[model samples]
Target: MLLMPENKDQLVSVLTYHVVSGKVNAADVVKLESADTVQGEQLMIKTTDGDVMVNNAKVVMTDVEASNGVIHVIDTVLLPE
Candidate 1:
């Protein structure tokens, strides 16, 4: 999955977001209030002006399926505090 070294950080965040639950769609995500990421931090789910955000980052593209789980592309890198 590390096709590019430059993407390692973003890749890790993407991978972490996948394991919270099984493959879930955008609509499903909207119904969820929060999810605990693999990084051990909680991701807050919120919708504003019809855009969905995980914590403070906006989900740009969602529902990308993978063998292990689903991937939701976000505008910013999520780091565990």
Candidate 2:
């Protein structure tokens, strides 16, 4: 979806849904069922046959460290409903 800031709240919500507060690595991610985002929503996490999925996106890369947190690259853009 094209997230234009037509509604500032909605745009921020959508963006925040992509982020979780703490630094969650791939190892830690597979252990959890869901994670709470900064947007005040829970993101569903699933692992099947050694494949990790966050929401509807497949995790492509993991353990990318940043100044504040780690980054996990996913195949698709996730949209919250």
Candidate 3:
């Protein structure tokens, strides 16, 4: 993911939401309420019945990890507005 400096806060939050309580699958994300990222930002996660949301985006893919951290593909790019 490419996060610009201005979007650092949102980036951190988004990154955190991607992390699993355990080694997660895409389905596990729906159960998260929040997460703290490596960059020291908190991400708000939301799930309603059969729906799940992260900030203002949806997780289209998940559990893609790297040596540095994990990646969850979101349908929309998040920015600090």
Candidate 4:
């Protein structure tokens, strides 16, 4: 099994894995099959039973607007393989 991130760089890599490089809304999110993150990885996106899943995380809340971008809340952390 892979070890958890133990350093700042590793933490940043894990954090950025959750982020998709643009302001994607919930409507657009469900339509997508996958997305690329700022950390230089591709995230697998899937919708099952009307719920959107990003990797293994479930998108709970979405479209939280910020000055720079939008935020989509997920139920779990997404880690790169």
lDDT of 4 by residue, 31-59 (tens): 99989999989999899998888888888
Error of 4 at 30 (Å): 1.1
Clashing pairs in 3: none
Residue pairs in collision within model 4:
none
| Candidate 3 structure quality by residue, lDDT tens digits, 1-81 | 347788776667655444444455556667678765444555678977765677787877666876755567778865433
> Candidate 2 lDDT, tens digit per residue, 8-72?
77778778989999888888999999999998889899999999999899999999999989999
> Each candidate's root-mean-square deviation in Å?
4.7, 1.7, 5.0, 3.4
- The C-alpha stretches of model 4 lying farther than 4 A from their native spots are 1-6
TM-scores for every predicted model = 0.71, 0.88, 0.53, 0.85
Instruction: Let me know the TM-score candidate 3 reaches against the reference structure.
Output: 0.53
**Scored by Cα lDDT, where does model 4 land?**
0.85
Q: Write the per-residue lDDT of candidate 1 for residues 1-81, one digit (tens) a residue.
A: 565999898678766664575567887999888987675668899988889998888999988888887788889866665
TM-score of candidate 1 relative to the true fold: 0.71
lDDT of each: 0.79, 0.89, 0.64, 0.85
By descending TM-score, how would the candidates be arranged?
2, 4, 1, 3
> Looking at candidate 4, what is the lDDT of residue 76?
84
